[model samples]
Target chain A: MEPVTTIHGRAYPFGQKNVDTDVIIPSHWLKTITREGLGRGAFETLRADPDNLFDSVEFAGSPILVAGDNFGCGSSREHAAWALLDLGIRAVIAPSFSDIFSGNAFKNGILTVVLPQAAIDRLIEVAQSQPIHIDLDSQTVTTPFQDRFAFDIDPFRKTCLLNGLDEVGLTLAQGDAIGAFEDTVRVERPFLAVGVGS
Target chain B: MATTHPRTLYQKIWDAHVVERRDDGTCLIYIDRHLVHEVTSPQAFEALRLAGRTVRRPDLTLAVPDHNLPTTARRDAAGQRIAIADRESAQQLAALERNAPAFGIRYIGDADAEQGIVHVVGPEQGFSLPGATIVCGDSHTACHGGLGALAFGIGTSEVEHVLATQTLLLKQSKSMEVRVEGDLGPGVTAKDLVLHITGVLGAAGGTGYVIEYTGAAIRALSIEGRLTVSNMAIEHGARAGLIAPDDTTVAYVKGRPYAPKGADWDKAVAWWRSLATDPGAVYDKVVVIDAAAIVPSVTWGTSPEDVVPITGVVPAPDSFADASKRDAAAKSLAYMGLTAGQAMASVEIQNVFIGSCTNSRIEDLRAAAAVLKGRHKAPHVKWAIVVPGSGLVKAMAEAEGLDRVFVDAGFEWREPGCSACLGMNPDKVPAGERCASTSNRNFVGRQGPGARTHLVSPAMAAAAAVAGHLTDVRDMI
Candidate 1:
C-alpha cells in the first residue's frame, strides 16, 4: 500500500446513485487470481458507451470520482476498490457509502469522503471543468473556485491511510494479546476451541 | 447493589469476543469461525504466501470452492473428474485446493457431499454456533446469524488480516431491532417478509447498524426460513443480521458433524439458552412491521429495494416524490424493459432460477417442489432449473423424490453450487431475457450481462415458471 496524503486531479463527475459492485467490476472479471489489470473491467457496463465519463479524454487519468449517495451498495468484493485503484482513482466523494465498501476502500488506501448532497452537487459542477483537491490531514475537499467542504473519517483509518500502514503487520505485533485471549477461551468457552490441533 | 448491565444480544457477543479495546473505540475482536470461498480468497492467500505468514488458527478456518465451480455434473459416467471449461475459474478453484492444504485449513472438495455455499455449509456443520463471531469474504455471510452468531462479510484485505491474526479491528455497530408482529398469511414466506422489509428499510437504511429480527412472526419461522431473512441483511446495507436462538435453532444444530457431543452439547445448550437479548434492553433503532400485510413480493427493478406486492402494478417513476428515486426508477424501467402501470402478473418472463444462498435449502426446495408437483412449466417459459444449496440438500431433495417432481414439471434438477445466482459458473440467463429468480439481488447483469432478474421466493418462482409471468403464489396455493 502506498501512502495517501493529498490528491489533486480532474474528477469523473459521475453522480449515479446506488452504484453497486456488480457495476464496478462484474462477477466475470473476478475470476482472476491476481489483482492487476482490473482497470480494463472497472465500470465495464457503463464504459460500454464510447463517450462514457471513464473513457473520455478529459477524465481519462482522473484521480478522483464524484458519485451519488449509497455508492458501492452491494457485494463485499474488494475488487471494486481494486478496480478503482487500477483506474487511478485515489479518492471518492459521495454523499454516503455502503459500510463494507467504505472499509474496503480504506484498506486499499483509497479515500472515501462523505459530504452533504449540496456539497456534492457543487463538486460535480466544478469537476466538469476544474480539478478537485482532497487533503487527508485536513479532511477537506477543495475546488479552485474557492469551494471547500469538510468531511469526517475514523481517526484510526485516517492515520492508516496517511502512513500507508500494513494492517496485517500491525495486528501481528499484537500476537501476544491474541494468544492470551485464546488461552482464556479454552477454559471459559471450551466449545469454541474444540477439535483444535488434532 | 451491583446493577446488571442489560445488554442486547449483539453487545453480549461483542463483549465476549473482545481480545482488546483501543482508545479510538476500535476493538480487536476475536473471530470464532472463518469461512473461505474460491473467488474472493485467491488474492488473500497470495498475500499470505508473500508475507510468509501461515494461518494463525487453521482449525478455526474452513474453505470451500463454490463460486467458480460448475453446477454441471462433476463426474462422468465412469466417475472421473469433469474438467471445468473456463480456464480462469478452474485456476481459481485450483488455487483454493492448493492453499487450503498448504495452510492446514479444512477444505471441502468439489465432489464432497458436504461441499456447498459457505454460508449454507457453516450452519449445516454446526461450525456457526450461537454467540460465535463468524466472518467470510462473501457478503451473504450474515446467513449464519440465523443461528444467533455475530457474522458479517469482510473484504480480501480483512480476509488476509484474519488469516494472519484470528481477530478483526472494528468499531461496534449501533443495534436496530426489526420486530414483525401478527401472522404471515398463506403463501407468504420468510422470503416475502424479508423482501417487504428491504423495501421498507430501503437499500441503505441499515447502513451502520446490525439488525436483530424479533417478534412472533419471526419466531414462527423455521430455521431455514430464519436463514432466508438474515441472508438479505446485506442487501439492505447492514453488515450483519441476527435472530436469537430458540428450540428450533437448537434442534437444527444438534448432532451435526461439527456440533458438540454429550457433556459439551449440554453445556453449549445452556450457554445458547442465555444468548437471547435481555428483556427491556434498548436498541438504537426499532422498525415494526405488520406481518399480515405482507404479500407475495417481487422486485420490479435492479435494486433490492425496488420491490412490490405480486398483485401490484408496475410503479411509474413519477410516483416517487424524491427526484433521485424517480430518476433511478426510470433507469430501472428502461434497463428491465418494463412499462409503467403494467400489471406485475402480466410481466412475462422466459426463465426461472430456484437457487442461491438465500433460498436453496431443503425447505426452499420442498416449497418449490410442492408448487411444481403436478404441473408443467408454461410453454413460453423456455428454461427453468432448481439448484440445491448443497450436495446434502440435493440428496435430501432426491430422497423425497423432489427431483422427479421438478423434472416432471419440465425444470432441470441441477447439482448445487450457487448455480445461476451470480452466473459465475456455466449457468446463466440469456441477455435481454427476463428471469423470475429466487436469488437475493436483481442487480444489472448479476445473472448475466443484460439479463433482467425479478427476485421472488422459490414457490413464487415455481409459480412464475408455470404461468410464464410473475404471478401470485397465493393463487397457485
Candidate 2:
C-alpha cells in the first residue's frame, strides 16, 4: 500500500445514504480474477445516467468523495475499496460508514472520514465547485471556504496509513508468539487442532 | 479483594483467541476456521503467490464454489461435465478449484455432494465450531455465529492476511444484547422476527457492535431458526451475531462430519456450555423486543430496513422523521416502483425465489414445502424456484419428499448455490419483474438489473407464489 498523507482534489458530491457494496461494484463485475480496471464498474448503475456526478466534467477523476450517512453499508467485498481506488478516490467523507467497508478502505489506504451530518451537508454543498483538502496528520477535512471538520480514526490505523505498513510481514515477524499460542492451545483444546495440518 | 470478571459470550471467545495484544488495544486474534468462496478469493490467492507465502494452516481453511455457478445442472444425463456458459464465471470458479488444491486447502468442487453456499456448508460439515473465530470473504459469514462461533466477513486483503497468518489484527467490538422475550405468534418464523428486527434497528444500527441474541423467544427457536437469525447480522450492520451454544447447538453439531468424537465431544460440550454470558455481564447497548409483535414481514423498498408486516401498507417517504431517511425512502420508493398506501398483499410479483444463505436449510425447505404441498403456483407467477443452500440440504429435503412437493406445485427444485439471490447466474429474475424472495438484501439490481425484490420468508414466498402476489403466510396456514 502507498503511504497516504494528504489528499486535495475535486469531490464527487454524491450524498446517497445506505449506498451498499452491491451498488458500489455489483455482483456481475465480481468475475474478474484480478483487481484492475474496476473503476468502470464502480457505481455502474448510477453512472448509467450520462449526467451523473461520477462522469461529470467538473468532478472527473476526483480524488475525494463526499457522501451521505451509512456509506458502503453492505457486503464485505474488497472490490468496493478497489473500485474506489481505481476511480482515483483517495478519501471519502461521510456522516458514517459501515464497519466492514471502513476497515476495507483503511487496509487499501483510502481514508474514511466521519463527521456530523451538519458538517457532511456543508461539505457536499462546498464540494460542488471547490476542491477539498484532507490532512491525515491533522485529522481534518477542509474546504477553501474556511469550512473545516475534524475526524477521529483508530490510532493504529492512522500510523499504518501514514507509514504504509505491511500487516502480513509484521504479523509473520511474531511467529514465535503465534507458535507459543498454538502450543498452549494444542494442550488446552486438542480438538481444535484435530485434522489441521495433517 | 478481587472479584471474578463477568464476561459476555463475545468476550469469552475474544479472550480465548488472542495470540498477542498490542498497547493500542489492537489484538492479533487467531482464526480457527476460514471459509472461502469463488467470488472474492482469486485475488487473495494471487497475493499469496506474489508474497511467496504458503497458507499457515491449510487444514483450517475450506473452499467451495457457489456465487457464480449456474444452479441449472453441472452434468449431462450420461454423466459428463457441462461447461459453464459464462466464460468469466467459469474462469473465476476454475481459479478457486485450482487455488484451493494448490494451496493444500480442502475444496468442495461443483459436482461434490458437499458443495453449497460457504456459510451453509460450514456448519453442516461441523467445520464451524463453538467458541471458534471464523472468517470468510463474504459478509453473511456471520451465519456461523449461529453455532456459537465468533464469525464475521472480511475483505479480500484480510482474506490474504488470514490465509498467510491464520490470525487477524483487530480491536474488540462493543457488545450488545438483542433480547427477544415472549413466544412468537402463530405463522411468525425466525425470518419474520429478523426482518422485524432489521426494521427496528435500521441498516446501520448494529454497526461497530457484536450482538448476542438472547431471551425466551430466541431460546425457543431451533438451530436452523437460530442460523436464519444470525445470518442477517450483517444486514443489521453487525459484523458478527451470536447465540451462545446450548443443548440445541450441541445436538446440531454432534454427528456432523468434523465434530469431535467421544471424550472430545464431552469436553467440547463442557467448554461450550461455559460460553454463555455470565450473570451481571454488562453490554454497551441493549435492545429488548417482544416476539409477539412480529408477523409475516416483507421488505417494501430496496433496503432491508424498508420492511413492514404482511398486513401493512406501503409507507410514504413523508412517514420517515429523519431527513436522510425520508430522502432514502423516496428514492427507494422510486426504484422499487411501489406506490404509497398500496396494500402489501396486493403488490403483484412475477417471480419467487426460495433460497439463499439466509433461509435455505432443510427446515426452511419444509416450511416452504408445507405451504405449497397441495397447491400450485398461480399461472401469472411466471417463474418460481427453490434452490437449496447446499447439495446436502437438497438431499435431505429430497429424503423428506419436499422436492416433490415443490415440483408438484410448479416450482423448480434446483441444485444448491446462491441462485437468484445476487443474480450472478442464469436464475436471475428478469428485469422490470418483482420477486417475492427469501434471500438477504433487497438492494437495487441485486437479483438482476431493474429487478425489484421483496424480501420474505420461505413460507411467505411460497404463499406469494400461490397467490401471484405478496401475501401473509398466516392466511395460507
Question: Model 1, range B34-86, lDDT digits (tens) per residue?
Answer: 99998888889887886678899999999988887888899999999999988
lDDT per residue as tens, model 2, B1-477? 123799999999999999998897999999999999988899899878966899999989999999988998899999998998889999999999999999999999999999999989999998889999999998999988889899999878889999999999999999999999999998899999999999999899999999999999999999899999999998999999999999899999999898888887888899999999999999999999999888899999998988899999999999989999899999988988899999999999999999999999999999999999999999999999999999999999999999999999999989999999996888888888999999999999999989999999999999999999999889888
In model 2, residue pairs whose N, Cα or C atoms come closer than 3 Å (at least 3 residues apart or on different chains), thus clashing, are none
DockQ of each: 0.38, 0.37
How high is each candidate's interface RMSD, in Å?
2.0, 2.0
State each model's TM-score restricted to chain B. 0.99, 0.99
lDDT for B6 in candidate 1 is 84
